[model samples]
Target chain A: MTGGYGLLVADLIGVAVFAASGASAGVAKRFDLFGVAFVGFAAALGGGIARDLVIGAVPPLAFADWRYAVTAVLASVAVFWLHPKLHRVRRTVLVLDAAGLGLFTATGTLKALDAGVPPVGACLLGMLTAIGGGLTRDLLTGEIPIVLQRDIYAVVALGGAILVTIGHRLGLTGLGPLVTAAVLMTGLRLLALYRRWSAPVAVP
Target chain B: MTGGYGLLVADLIGVAVFAASGASAGVAKRFDLFGVAFVGFAAALGGGIARDLVIGAVPPLAFADWRYAVTAVLASVAVFWLHPKLHRVRRTVLVLDAAGLGLFTATGTLKALDAGVPPVGACLLGMLTAIGGGLTRDLLTGEIPIVLQRDIYAVVALGGAILVTIGHRLGLTGLGPLVTAAVLMTGLRLLALYRRWSAPVAVP
Candidate 1:
């Protein structure tokens, strides 16, 4: 299942978009080039690395596959230079980020299940894979994680993870369920964003 | 080496001290009980889990062994309830934390070396194991990581790790070098703390 070309492409897209967002955040913070690249890499691959580690996929794909690192670094460098022009299309970046979040959730869940994690654990791992990168990125910049402080971001990923887990339980295979889950999550995230949907904060 | 009763005890002590520090931070931030516990666990075990994952130690000792989790959580709870009392002994806590930092660096390097990691990578893994928890703890509370922002904390860990790696290369075996490295690191950390020594920040 993981060997599929389509899934690989989707994963790379997710890495690139997430890297761009991370790089943009670094730029906003006025980090040096090295710091920006580090943040970009962390935001792009941190989640996948965490998921793989939890599932005992040692050395992690991020270390073994140069493509993931190259793609993330390239996207980050592009954002470093073109952020002024990119800012004009903030909506596009947001939409792409939503798509990346969804893709990560679907693929992460599938990978966890493939590695024999139980259904509940797989769902959690899936959510972690989706949100972990952004969390790291925010934390590095000394901002409260968006997933913890606001928005329906992680919830949407959780929803997609649940869907993938259910599909796996029902003997559903191949990319069909995974793609569906990703699409559904992306749509939900966009809806939530446009609607200003957010989880309630704890009362003071 | 891992099976040594001495190493096991040292590891638990490290976990407890780190957990206490994390819980204290959470309490200072006015986080609720659950958040305190979560922070404690992250601070105590996050590094070990990360090290285990990188080296392919599946399930991580923190998960596989109930004692590690129990020790961390108990320390966190204790800190939550007795922080006022603990405050009277802040110096003691600082000393213990230094010990923990040293122990983790030594054990982490040894484990990485045992796992066949090269000396340079082992040194890095050792430093990560020592500092990863505090970094996570600070990040969770929306603070820039101290390792990146100040002091000689991570550098001391790296020093201990390099010492252990050198010992390994010199055909020194058993607990002698590990203990020496841990002791040296702890002393260095304490001296640095009292002397207000810190690494210089990059100039703007």
Candidate 2:
């Protein structure tokens, strides 16, 4: 597949995983079906929408493309009905979430760069795209964002984005650098989880 | 002043008030100066950014205009330094918040209508504009949104937006209907607060 097509596929998978996570959160909160769907869609699209808006991309692709909405809603409905079974595979979900984070960071950075954003701004936008969905989900569920509370989540995304931005600046084209950066990001995030590594809370 | 210029001035005033409210919340949470300023800017611009994105307005005015940023920052700094004295006049802040809500709703609805949105969609956008900032503030502070919890806040904004949309459809142009709608909305919100009125919670 072409590089662009590969990125699109990765983005859709990321959306599905994020939607499932959001729907799970909604179910845990005892939200009704509509609420679950709303949360799921927000989690899937919020990051992309924010990125698009900041870059002056009108009518965010998530809103314009029917496929995104359909995918998110399907994921949400599946979680709503099959959560008990899904809950048994908590480890799988965590792994998929790491993958999603990596995919979004990579793609978001590339998009921002394509829009002529400077490297540093692109890196921040990439991190925002990785975390914004989960932030919106947590906010909708009335909880402090886990990103702000635990782990090196956002930092990991930023690290991946930096790699991508540097690769692009070095004339590394196509899926080679993108895939490498994504895999590295996912692996590092998993390692962080396994090692119980976390960012510091506050200064003494 | 022309209607558009008047709207711009009203929007700047709304930004200042919303920034102050957000800064006050940050102070209550004991956030540092930077955090308070960040929250202030977010509250001032979040609603307009959301509205601009939804309507396909590239480069949201809040981000493009230096005046908006300067106004919000000034308001935040003022509040950060003068909060103790400002707190003595709690009623004034409440009244200003109502006026901000009304002004945003009116202007948001008009902007949506100008963008060719249908009446219902415009009204919803207007309500979103009125409440989105406060919702962001509450989320950042780790609290449930007041609009969703208690009070007729969103509903009041929607009412004013509906009136503005109706007026526009009737070919009532200029600042006349917009000002009237805003005044009516502010009055109703104040009355609702005084009378302890609130939207219903979930059904029993």
lDDT of 2 by residue, B7-59 (tens): 78888889999999988887777655555665787798889878988887755
After superposition, candidate 1 runs with Cα above 4 Å error: A1-3, B1-41, B44-48, B61-135, B143-204
- What i-RMS does every model get? 5.1, 5.7
Error of 1 at A145 (Å): 3.2
Which has the greatest TM-score?
A: 1
Fnat of each prediction, in sequence: 0.24, 0.17
The digit string of per-residue lDDT tens for model 1 on A1-204 reads: 465788888889999999998998999999999889999999999999988889888678999989999999999999999989997989888998999999999989988888877676677679889888998898888786656555788878878898998988899878787788899999999999999987643232
Candidate 2 deviant stretches above 4 angstroms? A1-49, A53-143, A146-204, B1-3, B200-203
Clashing pairs in 1: none
Q: TM-scores of all models?
A: 0.62, 0.60
Single-chain TM-score of chain A, each candidate: 0.97, 0.96
